[model samples]
Target: MHKASSDTLRVSVVVPVYNRPSELRELLAALVLQSVDSAEFEVLICDDGSTVDLRAVVDEFNTMNSLQIHYFRQHNQGPGIARNLGLHNAGGAIVAFTDSDCIPEPEWLSELIGPIETSSVGMTGGLVDFRTADHLSGRCVNYLMSSMLGAGGARDPRAALHMRYYPRAGNTAVRRELACAAGGFSGQRHGEDIEFSNRILQMRTKIEFVPTAVVVHNEKKNSRQVAMEAFQKGTARIRLAREQGVHELIHTLPALLVVGLTASALTGLFLPAFSKIAGIPTVLYAIVLALIGLHGGFLLKDVRALLLLPFYASLMHIGYGAGYLYAFLTDPSTSVSLERQTVAAKSPHDGMSEQ
Candidate 1:
């Protein structure tokens, strides 16, 4: 751990990392290129018990740069807990957060802190998008969970359909005092940022959305990884509901989709007489999914990715629905294994919509 003397820093960039040394290096390089002066902010890297010695990366970067950087390590806790460690040691009035895998734009820090500095808002969340849309699987997955499909809340304030707009830990800035007073992060393996934002909202603290403050996530997920991430996200939603009573009918849409598809298939095979009527929902769903895929493909400018979108979305929906149903069936208090699954899935704080 490298402890630097605290100065009158204006912003503290808190980044929680785990087993991503290369990504951390990239983030550090990007931070050095920020429009905000190096003297105006500091970067704190909180390690979440990775097998690799991440300190070496931080030290190597520090030797060549003038950025004020501090490193902290803890046991294998979730990103939420690791972020709490950063928040506790933050030396600035404003605490900005971004994942190690994200490469923030030059104006990211400036844009994020600008609103909070000028307005009375307690926190602000910026935009998170893909570093690249070249990969077919990754692009399809992004489309499936994006605002275009009404399944995500990371890009815009109106993106969220199932949950209230909340700042994600990956690209958010909060007043140091207000975040600490709200009790920091909840230490959950997933959805901890949303829970934290919920607490901030309970305090009636306004959270603004800054579209220009952007971070490009270096996403490199395979088909399996995409499906597994969706599954973990679904399970995490249930956990949030159990703990916070945060429920929305839209959250159950995937599960209902699973059930409805299953029924339709079974009915078509076993009871051929009503197969046409039973298949109506399936046909309609396919049309909607196709339209979404077409739109995604147009935006990505990739025909191959568009064709693969439907299959990718099916995997996403099915996996998420299954996980949701599984978690919903299991008791929350005794769902130790489910929580472990979340960590195993390496679920990061997802982007939420603006309030």
Candidate 2:
């Protein structure tokens, strides 16, 4: 990559880190290999109160690559706050956000920046994908997320037939001034990216979704972690809806499936004939998931991964459903009201766009 003066910089790649020095190293290495000129872009690593000293990792990269890398340290607030610090300190006109665990493709920065610079759009985003499945949980989650039944639409805008594409921090770029005008991220731990995107929408800022700007997410979580992520996503959706008034019916599908399956199983225990009828949903769901798993296995050449999909799918759906129910039923109005208060306390200009 060509190196130029920092005065000519066009993009600021902001990554928030939290106790993941090794992952941060990998991401920094990938950033050094970006197709964009090294001087055209700079990196700001915002540490979110990590117990492990991450400065060494950033310093190592800076020395080895002679890259324009800056590091900031803050108390353990959250990713949103850390990102805001990066944004505030960034000097580039374009600000790109990605996670510490993601490794961007060579063309990732170039691809995302081209659209944002050439067009009238205020923001652009790319696909967050997995190149390999190292573990069973990764395999299962990757397979499910890549399918139409899962978040294929979310990962690729062309496939978003029913779902709308939102700019996630994991692979998104925005005009720095526009983002600042929109009040930056809202500091929500779970769905801050989506919440920030909603504010961008309120500004009527056009966002382009570019599928080629790929970032390989190095997610190596166990089954329990995967389930917990889904559960948190479920709750986050509700919180976002309450705060942003952006609701999607598709988010409730898993919860509905959970309720239906539970009711059907209970009814089947009392009526033997109804048991056969009740088994249809479960059977069909299993068969479809199994088929998806088989397809994944065929593509990856791993039969063991195929066998575990159904169980993983069950965990994803049930955990998400339980979380959705818990959030929705646990003093719904009070949570919404309190959330508003908290947001107001944190940042007065968070969700409001410049009028």
Candidate 3:
């Protein structure tokens, strides 16, 4: 990588962190090892009201590395708000965003920023690969996440480019000015990335998907964790669908299936004549489950993993279905007010404070 002049900071990598210190440390270490010149970029660690002060970690990195590191803190709002804070404080022309849990490849920064610099594209997103660990549950989470069904086609390069699929904030980089002009990010807990990307697209800004700029997401989610994430995502989907369009419902297929199957079963339970009819949805659900297992097994190429696929898939579907239903039934005003209440309860800190 060519080194930039001391006076010019070409890229600013912004990471919004919560309470995952170990993961944040790993991500920082990965950033320090980027092929780009240390002088060409800076890292901004935005702490979203983590209970523990992450200053020690930032201090440790600053002391050991020549790369410039900055830290800021805010009361627990969400990653979206924390990121907006980082963007406001960033000095670089290019703003790169990644999660605290992701470890970018050595060439990630260069590849992600290259398109925006060389082409008319205002934004670029990299590929995210799940890291496999020794733990079975973790591997299960990885398989589920990387699978096409699990990601709802967002990770697929073809779909991303042609299907209007938006990139996740964790692996995207944007031209700082365009990002700011697009009104930055919203305070939504989930789907904020999609909402932000949609805004950018509305401006006719080119957003490219760079497959070479890869990041390994070390997500260690157990079965329960996976279900909880699915649930949260489902609820977020309802909001997105309301704002974007009914097309957003494509991402909520599993949840819809769950709702359909459950309603069918409940109907049969209430009416004895429809008891046999209930078996129709049950069979359909079973077939879907089988397909999920097959898809997961095909991706992992591990027969043993199939044993747990059913349980994990069921939890994912059921949890998401419940959340989606709740969101669908709830009043939009009520939900928005609740979110505002949560944000209002947390006071915002002033300016950036380096740890």
- For all candidates in order, the CA lDDT equals 0.77, 0.77, 0.76
Q: Which candidate ranks first by lDDT, i.e. highest?
A: 1
Clash count of each predicted structure: 0, 0, 0
True-structure RMSD for candidate 3: 4.7
Candidate number with the higher TM-score (1 or 3) = 1
Q: Where does candidate 2 clash, by residue pair?
A: none
Residue-level lDDT tens digits of model 2 in 1-355: 2244436888989999999888898899889999998878888889989999898887788778767888888888888888887777676888899999888989999998998888898999888664363355665576566556654355566653446678888899998887787777766677788888888888998988888888877768777887898888778878877877767777788888888888788878988778988888888777867776777678667777677766777777788877888899885885453121122122312332211
lDDT of 3 by residue, 83-137 (tens): 8878876768888999998889899999999999898999988887643443556
Against the true structure, what is every candidate's RMSD?
6.5, 5.0, 4.7
TM match of model 3 to true structure: 0.85
Model 3, runs deviating above 4 Å: 1-7, 131-139, 159-163, 267-277, 301-304, 332-355
Which one wins on TM-score? Answer: 2
Cα lDDT of model 3 overall?
Answer: 0.76
lDDT of 1 by residue, 247-341 (tens): 67778888998999999999999999999999998998899778777877787778886678777777777888988988888865653322311
Worst lDDT run of 10 residues, candidate 2, spans: 340-349
